[model samples]
Target chain A: MKLRRIEGDLWEIPREGRMRVPGRVYSVGPPAPDDPALQQVANVAHLPGILRFSLAMPDIHWGYGFPIGGVAAMDAEHGAVSPGGVGYDINCGVRVLTTALEAEDVRPRLHAVTAQLYRDIPTGVGAKSAIPRLSDDALDEVLAGGARWAVRRGFAAASDDAERCEEGGRLSGADPSAVSARARTRGADQLGTLGSGNHFLEVDRIAEVYDPVVAEAFGLVPGRVAIQIHTGSRGLGYQVCDEFVAEIAARRGEFGEDYATLPDPQLAAAPIASALGQRYLGAMQAAANFAWANRQVMTGLAVRALLHALAISERELGARVLYDVCHNVAKLEEHAVDGVVRRVLVHRKGATRCFGPGDPRVPAPYRAAGQPVLIPGDMGRYSYVLAGTARAMADTFGSSCHGAGRLMSRGEALRRGRGRSIARELAARGIEVIARGKKTLAEEMSEAYKDVAQVVAVMDGAGISRLVARLEPMGVIKG
Target chain B: MRLSLPQPYEDLGHTADVGVRTRGATAEEALARLVLAFAALAAGGAAVAAEREERVAVEGGPGLAGSAVALLRELLYRLATEALVPAACEVLRVDAAGTEAVVAFGRRDPVLHAEGADLKAVTWHAARLEREGAGWVAQAVFDI
Candidate 1:
């Protein structure tokens, strides 16, 4: 269980006890001695056909099977895909859009803008969408076509919205038939709605620019207004993950005795070529598409809300997507393994894909400067924008930390925030926060999360991602 | 009604999610209590009056753990789609195949009944349903 400092900003757990590979953690310093994330990393190494090492970003924290901020690449020919690696919220991600307006222009109307956003975008537990419910056929199209469906339906500003997303906002293998009717029923009316617990929509300002050239390329300049949306496939994704994990675990007897010895039953997996695996991939991809479409629809909603709040036209607002990134997902990508390039299924659970500059996968507009990575911090503080690096490709499978990871449990946060006015606290700091209830505000206070600047600094020092800009939240809406 | 002496469930600490541990006189009783516990958490400690009933059927191959997860997921699905909160659950039958139950739930009224943590899913992580002495105990972790 001892983590050895193998190099600067890197630590390793030597292979032992049925581990197929060593466990690697990217950190600015050694992890706390009793951190459960170390054990989770080691547990992931026990997975079948894990290549090189089971990796964790500096934001690593204890999770069910794979630690949050964990990354692993498994050989497609021999490896298995586990739902736990993608977590329950399939394709949970962040999307940031830039506007022509500057912070000074919106500062005076922060309250009105935030209120309009809250009114237009539904939030809270089981909040229904402002849009009408989708018919079965429409829902299926959304699942299969992803953000493309949104663009087609006029929910997106242009086709470029799809182009700016990972997988072009549509996973090619998504099979609507693979998804269960129950999941569809749960998702039918939830599009464009933000579900509770850590999901949010924030209006921020580019507070500072680090790499001015890259920032300009990303359309991020100091004092400019930007909007960030964080959400996922909603109830649909959770049901897909739940059904598969149970199905695979129930069939463990058929996977041979080796399966019975897995460190956690929740780590249930099937070979990539197996029937169950193919079915799961189809369903997962469909959920991923649903999420992309969800965010896309929300983007349109946000634009309308912002324009309405400011009593301006779309031309005046000039809202446009900067980029969208999926954090919880698994995809087949070609990567160099032991010096030979091969296709592998990369599982990034609470980790973002950060393809370096010049990679074909990077969106063409940003190909020369790498993909833009959005790291949202907790309310009442600053978020970050970073660009991928070549070192990320060579060392960490082109993945980086997702967000400012949780530093306290929700219960602990609530207890600590007891009798305190979280809204007043934020307002005093010149930030406006709107939520359905006070409990969510307390549960999500800034103290509950690690300083995102510190987390980004670790990634920057490790050379996986370099800073581009810092965004300070001016107004926030939480679900 | 007028209830028992010992509390059937208690909340356990988790780093990022919510966990519950329940005890009952039998496995069926324990499963029922677990359902009520889940409902309580979802209801955010609001007093729920059972005014309606919902039937749920789930199948698991062998162990009690898989069956428990299936049951919990069914409850969650119903809650998400129908806005019903279970106040009580009666285990109708249990076999090697699975369990069938009828849950009595409260009507959806956001004005009168506020929502609590929005549980995303019930995970199988470290889930346990076992016999301890002459009684049974069950534990589950929920993604909120």
Candidate 2:
């Protein structure tokens, strides 16, 4: 499929046949050669009841199930949802924590903070959380309450956290019955944990403020310190994917002979109206809620760790959730198509929601300010905070890049790290680092990614999101 | 093929870290044996000892972090394709950030002690390898 350049940062893949919509790609230049992301956009176009153009964010990459940064909206009435669309790590997302402490105030405690975070937060693959295991009934509450569940359980404070989350941290229609027994078993003890690979807890300083009004609204002051927690549902989400993929594989032939031609087997799916589709959606939403709750609990744990290390009270620390948003998810949203408002299931894998100003889905406090867009860069580089724009609603379905996309494989990072002491190296740069595995540290080395600056620039140029603040890393804890 | 007790890794899923090396009459012959070791894990029992030529290409970071994952994935790919896992792998050419290698299989293949499932990916968790004395020590995490 040839991608025809449309404008400054947009490309279009014409709807050839059997496609409900054409495909639109957002990028800076021609996509990287041999990029399969375009193919994913085309595949999404073929899904039943798709509206407008199947969208791909600027940070698009080849992914197993859905192309990373892929988004497609399927009409709620005529469309179908696919588990491949939401990805294995359901609701994998990022959360930023603001602090009253300045960079200088925390400089001496950076090492202690990193160590404390690592010890307090469960990390690494299969790492269990310190929180108690949930019973079947309690798990049901988590599905419905999300961050609210944590707050009620004393994991997080409702006063401090309830307003800063998308959907107030709890999405509606999360039915625990939709979750499989295997998923529950796997997630039973994984709450309040930061699982491995790309998930991290980083200490950062507000480096630059681009919009003082928005920065002040977000409680972000230049040189003020903050923490970023990046994680998701962990093993539980994996279990859901594992269960659904097998279920889909068992019934792929039922989708008819044409299903075999699917560009990628990972895209195997059932019709949105099918029983399988409903089951997958229910489970996925439950898992997504689990992830939201997981991050909230982890945030609370970090706050406690900070208070202990600094010998300060919660009020003194002034730690609060700036904003929490999930990048990997499939959501039911209403978008206008050809002048008609239609409910569509939008799948965003490795893409963050950037709802424009005045969008009702955006919380009331931020109605005029627009939704916050948090884009975390590499540890050695910088991360950014942006706001949604009206153009995002008119063009790209209110979505933006997730992070500095990976440029090198993990094997490459370790190979490059041969004799280097990554820990010592970061410490010398005024950053503290701690991890469960050296190889993970190496594979995730700052050099293994595209400069997030370039990635964010494309989104900004494309008018999907607007820059608000830039943050510099002071310490990091990796699983 | 004989099984060995490897150390448990903190992050690797259901994996064993074993020290493996191969030597033959020549360097090329020895390298071929190493590939065999890797193939043995994926390939099930099949009679008739035969050799076939294969090519492996890896790019980006060359050391254990970057190359090991691709190398392992390639080895698994072959096993998935041939339905016969190599018993051992021989490193033919190991440039700092890259590697070239061959594999060897067992003579009389027995029922393989593995399952019929795709090994989706190899992760960076606990992936490490160090040159100790004359040989190399390494570890990796796989998404099974």
Candidate 3:
């Protein structure tokens, strides 16, 4: 792979072969020669009607077809839509909430709060639902309504939570009928439950504020305790992607004229105008909606547990959702292309939308500051809150890195963590770590990830997104 | 006290994903062994009792890889939806195109058995079945 420096934390793979666009990456260090993610980036460039560049964020890492933290936009009318691009976990996103209580107030009772949360919120594989099983009609409503459904059912911590979410929680064009029966069955019981593997509920405190103005605008007060929910559409999302990716890959010839030439079979795509593509879009949107509602419902459960454990009234907690942003998704957005603005379906896998100030799509309350980009780091260290910037819109389709990318494989992490108590290790750092299995914690130890500060610094240095505040983890519950 | 048999497949690690590699004297044996390895993983290494038996079939493409994927997918779907863990997989027949196998299953008791990894989907990344060292070896990666 040939790499060229493009000034200031940016690198490019010059368009060659059957590539329709050049490949771009934001990182302090260039990718290794044999990195599969490098090839994955180049392969994305081969997609039809790709615009500007097949872009990657600073925390880029090896994912199945698309590199995690990768972003690409395609011409709506002339391009392809790959289920693989959005990933199996549709709308796997982060929700950040600000609370009135300070870290000092919650530090002593953190363990009780965490234990109550674990008991209140279902965790682990085959975890039962916290809410009663939904009827078929209600399931359809959830598929279509997203966080709005949660709010209606009183599963939202705040009334305006849905309003603060990306696309107002429910994605437009969701066709519940498009969602398969198996997905519905699997997802119906998963609402308010936290699924396993990298999914978590974290309690954090604002340790530093970089942009005080923006922080104030978003209600992120320094030293205030906050909550973060990291999850997705769960089995529902996975089933939808699995069905479509396999169906499209097997019937690739029927979906596109040049399907056989796809750089990777997993990168199989359908023409945006094709029936299969439309069907996938409808189903994917449904899954994305389910995830929003899922997160919102979990928020309600966690907030309840916190209030109970602290023996405080809801008003006293003063919790308000700041923002909910999806990292894995594809959205039709208008962006500048070749000196002209046009609509493109931007695929963000392990990436977050960071629309700059003045975009009407941004919620009204924080419109002056820009959309809040939530990046969840490892359990031990700190997470970040960034504000979208005009440079982000100009450079990477209003996208930014999601988190500290994996530096080592899960196997490697386990091999290194052998005989060491990861929980005690985190406890020594003043972080209460509660997980079902030690293996999961070991696999997710901080050493398994790159320094998140470095990853975010690249985007900040590149002027794409700016840091607003940082949240240090005080406690964590991994499903 | 029991003597557990050595696993046919070993962990094949990637930078972000996980997989299994298996070797057997024949393609059928290799495919069957691959099925057991993944099933055991989904059961979190718990010993599944052979409470019932069923013959499973999957249409194949050109080689063992495609058939293996189809088989694993069917099993994954069953495990996720029905909690049916394969206690033993005996490949009745296998060819370049398709496969037929008899699997002994244990109805996984959530309270009795260990909870397992969510085997989201069986992906087609680097999946293959080939002859190596006078034996058949196969590998597949699951999207976890």
Maximum-DockQ candidate? 1
Return the lDDT, model 2, position A49. 64
Fill in the DockQ of model 2.
Answer: 0.04
Cα distance off (Å), candidate 2, residue A311? 0.4
Which segments of candidate 3 are over 4 A away from where they belong? Answer: B1-6, B60-63, B94-98, B108-115
lDDT measured at residue A306 in model 1 versus the true structure, 0 to 100:
86
- Score candidate 3 by DockQ: 0.55
- For model 2, residues B1-144, the per-residue Cα lDDT tens digits are 222112121222121112234333443333344344333322322222445434466541334434554466555434432444444444565444566765443332322332112232333333445554554445543442
Encode model 1's per-residue lDDT on A41-123: one tens digit a residue: 99899877789999999888878888999999999988889999999999999999998998999999999999999999999
Superior candidate under lDDT, 1 versus 3:
1
lDDT string, candidate 2, A1-479, tens digits: 77788888788888886666888887756886456567777877776667788888877766654667888777786666777788778899999988889899899988887788889998764568468889999888887788888878777633758668987887787778978776787788889988767889999999999999988887889999989999888777766775675467546778665453455555666777788888888888889889998999998899889888888878778887889999988888888777787777888878999999899988776778889899998878789999999988877677788988776655456678889988888889998888776766776788877788888999888888989999999999887
Checking candidate 3 for backbone clashes, the offending pairs are none
**Predicted model with the maximum lDDT:** 1
Q: Which stretches of candidate 2 lie over 4 Å from their true place?
A: A17-20, A157-160, A256-260, B1-144
